[model samples]
Target: MDVVFSDVKGMKEEQEQQISLVAERNNVSKENKFHKDEQRKERMLELFLRTKESILEGWRQW
Candidate 1:
């Protein structure tokens, strides 16, 4: 009976550890996705500004 109890306790601990690892991985993935999105937004803004400047310069030439 004691051996069976010990086995059950060990299994429970292992399951908890797996759950913790999965949660950590999910958090990291969310952070990475947010960072990528921020980078994409920054690039798009830069492109927009450059295009606007080009249009203004062309008007000046005219």
Candidate 2:
């Protein structure tokens, strides 16, 4: 649980940084790059969260 918690925290921090970078770049003339990157990151985060939930649920079942 602790490990999962720490991982989620780290991932959240990284996601924040990624989003912030995109936000900063938004002022400049960039096409779908930022949007694509954000979508990619979001999808990755969602997968990670789902995997984490599944693992936790499995642990609980044990």
Q: Highest lDDT, which number?
A: 1
Steric overlap count per candidate = 0, 0
lDDT of 2 by residue, 1-62 (tens): 99999999999999999999988788553656778889999999999999999999999999
- Displacement of the residue 56 alpha carbon in candidate 2, Å: 0.1
lDDT of 1 at 23: 100
Q: Which candidate number maximizes TM-score?
A: 1
Model 1's alpha-carbon lDDT is: 1.00
Q: Estimate the lDDT of model 2.
A: 0.91
lDDT of each: 1.00, 0.91
How does residue 53 of candidate 1 score in lDDT?
100
Model 1 residue pairs with clashes: none
Tens-place lDDT digits, model 1, residues 1-62: 99999999999999999999999999999999999999999999999999999999999999
Cα-based TM-score, every candidate: 0.94, 0.51
TM-score of candidate 1 on Cα atoms, chains taken together: 0.94
